[model samples]
Target: MSSGTASSGAGSDDDHAPWPSPLIRDLVDELRRFNRRKTEFYAESVLEASAFAIMLVLSDGRARTLRELTEELGLEQSTVNRQVNNAIKHGYLERFEVAGSLSRFVRPTDTGREAFHHDGMLRAARIEATFADLAPGTPEGLLRELRAFNQAYDRRVLRETGKDVEATGEHRRYG
Candidate 1:
């Protein structure tokens, strides 16, 4: 948690010095490790991570346009398009247009819903087992803290970039 900066060179100014806080370094390392472990777990699942994410978002049975999905997932249009196309090819998803709308919306097929449920149960079991080994209330506390930290981080990013979350429609989509 050290706030004192460490100099990279003898004459380096404090304003230009990189943050050498142990807390920041540890946070980065732990995040990377968590991501790696999560990736490894998903590698054994039937659906790819992107597909699973899309399915999860569509799990409420509501169809969403590609633009909506891209914005919700915070991914580039090309990436979401590629993933959606792959899911459609696999029969897990389908695209349809509303009667008067030019935009095509994507939704999960029956197979996709079944697969998503199956994978979700598996993931839940794994998480529950892991949580069982932790101290009581630890998981809940961690989740609360993580959510708070993410909100703060997002707010800071928006403020620094002079971007309005509402104007971007992110607050409406996620808030």
Candidate 2:
């Protein structure tokens, strides 16, 4: 038997891999898992994530226009409209027009605000529990790293596809 580190028949390097690196593929996989967990949490809460996002935006007690919400959420206009309509239908939001402005605004109702705060507290507690084993500042560091990685990935996509992927906020299949 060899005394050196034993190889598992296959090497770590994968020049033939489609992705630029294995780490990138792993990162994508982790992000997919994160999103899956988030969706699960929302489902378990008996609320759609989009609706929660709308509630969050309106929870400040300040009226916000649909366009503003769309931009803030980085979601498409149609998606924002649909979520807003749903919220209105559920009586979590009320639409009104400012006297001087042509744009209509949506504000959270008392029920909506209460729900938002309750959900937010629950989510925060869950997150805190999940990270209880981690050292302090680890989550913040990870967030910073993710932000940097996203910026780099955006630049790479722009260079390869000549498209601003971040601006569009759409995932496209790239060769």
Candidate 3:
């Protein structure tokens, strides 16, 4: 077994298989740690992480149909519907229909916008404080690398799924 790899204990052939590159394994581990720490930061938040994500997507004050939200978030339609309904129940969002359209659009209410902004600021402050001792420009460099990695990952996913960026409307956001 590789020094850093864990065994399944069953002694199957898979256990002796070559593991992923160290860099990949380390990146995965760090991502898991980051997610756990991020959850802690939102433990006392007014909105759950999923709810905050929905609001973030709509933070520009533009209305989006549930389909659009689902596509943008890469979440199931039912999941998006439930989150949007919950936001509406909390008076953070509203669903309205255009006079001639059957599709309904969801938009953030005044209260929702205020709450989103306040929560976002608090989260940002916590993150900034956590990384305060880092050398200048470190955060910007990290963000740049993260964005590049995400774009590359997204492109790979599209290629493997045989989907085009235009078909998924990802180009609008990622491009």
Candidate 4:
């Protein structure tokens, strides 16, 4: 048998052949290619990808602790703290104590909220313009699959890191 062909069973057919099927490989490759546009957009937008991602997560006006944000963003605690500190320094975020605990909540300020709205609009326009040529349901289907991919990725991350990120299982609507 060739190295690429598996010898799992005497009667097994190509249907159950082996690891990394063509569909899986193709999906991974396509995701990598699609991610390039995101990287390029962030590069041209003058905001670091990390910062932008952080802002997007916080755009819902729901205050999240540093640890919560770190796990959600899948970034190191120190990195998230640094970004939080930077946001605070720039007046984009405010950190307040949780009354009786040392834990603090980082919430966006009015200016930060405005920034989020502006960024959301810019991103929506960019995506709309880019996918305007696609069929009517294509973009919606892609968004649904992307959300599923994100959940799977988060699950894998939790298994590897021992940190659980709460999955809302629902997409946040942005206007």
Report the lDDT tens digits of candidate 3 across residue range 1-175: 2334444355554443354544454556667766675346465577767778888788766788999899877789999999899989999889999888789999988888888888887888886886796666466787778778767877998879877655554544421
Q: Which stretches of model 3 miss by more than 4 angstroms? A: 1-18, 36-44, 135-137, 166-175
Residue-by-residue lDDT tens digits, candidate 4, 57-159: 8877688888878777767999999988887787778988877777899888877776666766677788788788656746778878777777788688788
Ranking by lDDT: 1, 3, 2, 4
Cα TM-score per model: 0.77, 0.68, 0.77, 0.68
lDDT of 2: 0.69
Model 4 regions lying over 4 Å from their true place: 1-19, 36-39, 42-47, 148-175
lDDT of 2 by residue, 49-146 (tens): 77787776555556888887887677899989998999788877889989999999889877777777777777877877777876775667866776
Q: lDDT of all predictions, in order shown?
A: 0.75, 0.69, 0.74, 0.67
RMSD (Å) of each candidate, 1 decimal: 5.4, 7.6, 4.9, 7.0
The pairs that clash in candidate 3 are none
The window of 10 residues in a row where model 1 has the poorest summed lDDT is 1-10
Task: State the displacement of the C-alpha of residue 40, model 4, in Å, after optimal TM-score superposition.
Answer: 3.7
In model 3, which range of ten residues has the least summed lDDT? Answer: 1-10
lDDT of 3: 0.74
